[model samples]
Target: MCATHKAFFSYVWRKFLNMYRFSVISSFLALSCFLSLASYELPDHSNGEPTTDYSINEYWLSLFSGFSKDVDVFYVYPTSWYKLDPAEPDFCAIDHPTMLSRSKVVFDIQATAFETVGNLYAPYYRQADAAYTLSLPADKRWAVVDSIPAKDVIAAFDYYIKHYNKGKPYILVGHSQGAQVLMLLLKNYMPEHTGTYARMVCAYVIGYPVTAEFMSSNKHLKFAESAEDTGVIVSYNTQSPSVAPGANIVLGDEIGLVINPINWKRDETPATAEESLGSYMPIDAQGNPALIPHFADARINMAKGVIECSSVNETDMFNLSGKMGPEVYHSFDIPFYYYNLRENAQVRVNRFLAK
Candidate 1:
């Protein structure tokens, strides 16, 4: 918990203890507890350490805001910020001119999967620069991710639950850097927000690994064993068979639980390219944004704990790569099974609501 939130709740408790009549205090306390559970507004962003104003209209590049549905999708975009100069700050500000535009493009491409199932809420956070963040070892990478970037997302989420959610079920989705931070968000923030957690149909933490340590620590965390399992995480890192075992997104020594995007199974059973509904390929140096029907196949590489795409050529996939080797399909994790994800979300939500 942030110190500011602690202080706010403490202030509420102090006031709760001081009321004169026991019954009056009891009634008011119940209201206060309800209000607390409902939403928590963060303190003003005046402290100026890359403080993100979630209340401001510009900070959020939301695609589907006001909703007609009972569910919502909170999307965090992958690493678009690439800081080459060592002297510059390690994070991308919420208002970085090009970053905002890139976020919109990325969202339209990535977040659209859930648009049919729920309203989209994609926030502009001061996220870690891809180059700077990836250069570091795992521990340092996490430190950078846990700093200002973490705060922006947590605060944005709190604002979301505070102002928008109103008890509606929601799904969390992210790719690459966004996926890593979402993992941290689930670990650090969700424990205190169990009510909100319970309403999650599933978290599509795509293009990242969900460690067994994480599952053990957050006992509430569950890897989706089936397509229709509500309140579980659906995740898989995509790489071709040639990417080499350890070259994928699997964390060192930590077990990453993976589910095949096509079959939604945890085992090594191969789901063929023919079963793949389609892939919404992002416009790369090669081509324009286009949907290729039955683009890639998914089969779990159990030894490395990642989805190994075979049957179709990995080089044929459209994406812009930087430091990551050509074989790693980190960019295509969602796009590879865009239709499947969209369909599975509806299936899960339907199952959740049915129960």
Candidate 2:
């Protein structure tokens, strides 16, 4: 071959190799960018410090102005934190933006049930992830799950009592993990502080189990006998009639007292769907506030310690992801009996006042 032809071919080969190398480098950089965008990380707290503020104005969801009611609803919200860096922290930080946003939606759907009957006071505490209780065996999970979150709840309650409660009668309301924290609060706080127990209207601990052992041990706390019963607990776990009880949410053999919010009865009486006044759905078709009315019938199954509902309008609000079956209606516990609970709160409040 000619020398000129050999030189030209060599130049072409080198250019081709350079272009291929450039393409490979560009593709590698693009893939890295995509992975970074896809990866999930817990929101970074300022200076990596968890918030410690529990002042009524800062944490309370509803701080009524120029209005007073005979009863105050001290509510604890359910599992709103989904992300955790198993290495970084077990309990979610209170001021984390994601936790704050999620807790607001919970307050609207669950806490609003008591708005008409009393002044609502919901505190934002460090709540364990939904899987916190389910990830480990019953014995191990309860201790770890309650450790950090329980302290914040106790502190918040103390703050509420000293500043906001002002000798007013109060109702303890909690759902799912919130209920678990409140159970600890009731057992530890109320028994020692008899004044707080005397002013208590009732405790509505929904979604989580309140075992017979716990109640029997805590003599000051009484389970509700009827709708108008004062200073008692109104608790129940809801599921479809087909779903059996024995889920992790209700630990142990001794299932505690359950009152049917629909019928306001302790027995296995079926309350028709017509009896449910309304359920406050946080979002509408367009993602707006929509308070929907009467979509479920409830009947207590004394054998299982859960309320069996006939129907549920399964929306994003009711959608919960867990090991629990369809029968484990944890999300719909409050909404299913929204109005019934509101009216029952008034009944108990009035009865407490009368006495």
Candidate 3:
């Protein structure tokens, strides 16, 4: 090789090696930080473990004040066994949950898959010009009320019913543990308050199951299968039929209720309505830009290729390039599945209101 070319190749080789080293280090720091955050010690609620009551209450209050449309939406977030009580004045003082073993972590990995997918439905409760709020309850606290099935969520909803919701239409959204609780509420609590059902604009219960038994036993339970803009159920799960993760599995029974995260309709193909998000006018399944919800749709432009590339085997997906710090990464990467779902949801919710 010529001397100049050899020097250039040497430099490129060195750069690649440095980049590789940086990737390894960054991933470690990022994972460590997430562990630190996820493992924070929770407070001792009256029953023992921490409670998500505070987060749920705050979210409801925020959503109530944030929107001017005069509608009510009940939102819930699932709990992780590793959840720490954010309400505790001194969250760092308590020790981490050492009782949780590696297997528990794997279980949580699968459980949180649903949690992450479920909570993404929050922005769907409002119109293009309005705002929606989300409140999440902490999970896995020792307090009887702090666990996923704890009383905080129900109590919060009851509080809203007693104080705010009278005749206005509403939406119900939840994920994982929250979805489980919401399913129960729909089956038990909402029925007693039949008026609540009449007002339900829609319910997006992701990452939780509404079993065939539940559907069969209760004539009232049904999944939304249209884009007509009415009250409906939207749910779905992510999987390649051949590459199943084997444990903490979400089976056919559980997966049956999941709707396509793309278009809200049950029968439509799970392809993006607009192939290139960064365009002037985007169209839906009908190929009409007039029907698109712009604000929510902006995400498609920003995250067009994230989901398929989410599983970066290295510690960090983005290189530090010599920057010294922990680099954290969230799931639902580029072409964020959640953002597309959020946009699709807004479009559907708006249609429901227009009618």
Candidate 4:
């Protein structure tokens, strides 16, 4: 071979090897980056440390800072940790970043409804991950769900009552799994402590199911019949008119309570959309009420025991559809009736005080 041809071939071979090495390194680095993002886990709260100390300010999302109100509200937030790894930690530590971010959204959208009517107090409890209940079998799920989360709620409520409540009439508000915890608290805690139960202005247990069997068994608690009814429980799960009773989050065999927040009625009578005060969506970066959408009408399905909204704008961010159907508005139970809930809370508080 000629010396010039050999030199040129040698140079070409070297360039090809360099490119091959660069491509291999780049591919490995890209895979590492993707794995790091996907495997991101929440902080481990499994150290057997005491998760809450109400004496410290960090344990509370909102504490009494000398603000005065006729009544107090003790709120429990819904499922905020959706991506929590079952192997890493089942319960979210109070300072978990994702939990805090999601909880803020819940407060902004749901807890704000009661701000005008009372002194709001939301505690940072060790909430169970969203997967805890959904992943387990029906018989096994409740046992796991009610374990850690319920203890945190009960402890928080006890602390709130001892230090903050000061014998003031208070309202209990909880959504989704939070509602389930409160229901357990009502059944297990209230009976032993009659005075505390008596002091409860009302309980707004929204988004979760409250079965007829459970209500019938708990004689001390009464489902709210009218807007002004105090010392009662107001509960409902919102769905589209087309969604059937057994579909979605609501089980077919279960008979749960329902109330139309717009009209504040327990019966199936339709409340017009014009009657709806407003439905507030999530806040933007500026922390303002993002959007307020209105529906045409709302009514309780007597047989299904779920609120059936009419002429719902599916395009709205809050009016979401799921595998169950277009009627699955579980996340927007509070936002969908924001104004009506706020006003109804005040009305009930006034009636309670009058008596």
Runs of candidate 4 with Cα error greater than 4 angstroms are 1-51, 84-86, 137-139, 250-253, 282-287, 290-293, 315-325
lDDT for every model? 0.71, 0.69, 0.38, 0.71
Name the candidate, 2 or 4, with the larger TM-score value. Answer: 4
Q: How accurate is candidate 2 locally (lDDT)?
A: 0.69
Alpha-carbon error at 264 in model 1, in Å?
0.9
Evaluate residue 301 in candidate 2 and report its C-alpha lDDT on the 0 to 100 scale: 80
Give a tens-digit lDDT track for model 2, residues 57-150. Answer: 7766566555898889999887776543434354666777767876776687688889888888887787655443444455554665457677
Best by TM-score: 1
Candidate 1 residue 234 C-alpha distance from true site, Å:
0.9
The per-residue C-alpha lDDT of model 1 at residue 325 equals 55
Q: TM-score for every candidate vs. truth?
A: 0.82, 0.79, 0.50, 0.81
Candidates 3 and 4: which is better by TM-score? 4
Q: If ranked by TM-score, best first, what sequence of candidates would result?
A: 1, 4, 2, 3
- Cα error, residue 145 of model 4, in Å, equals 2.7
Q: Lowest-lDDT window of 10 residues in candidate 3?
A: 125-134
* Segments in model 3 whose C-alpha atoms lie over 4 Å from true places: 1-63, 80-150, 240-242, 245-253, 265-335
lDDT of 1 by residue, 132-200 (tens): 444445666677777787788888988899988888999999887788878888988888988988899
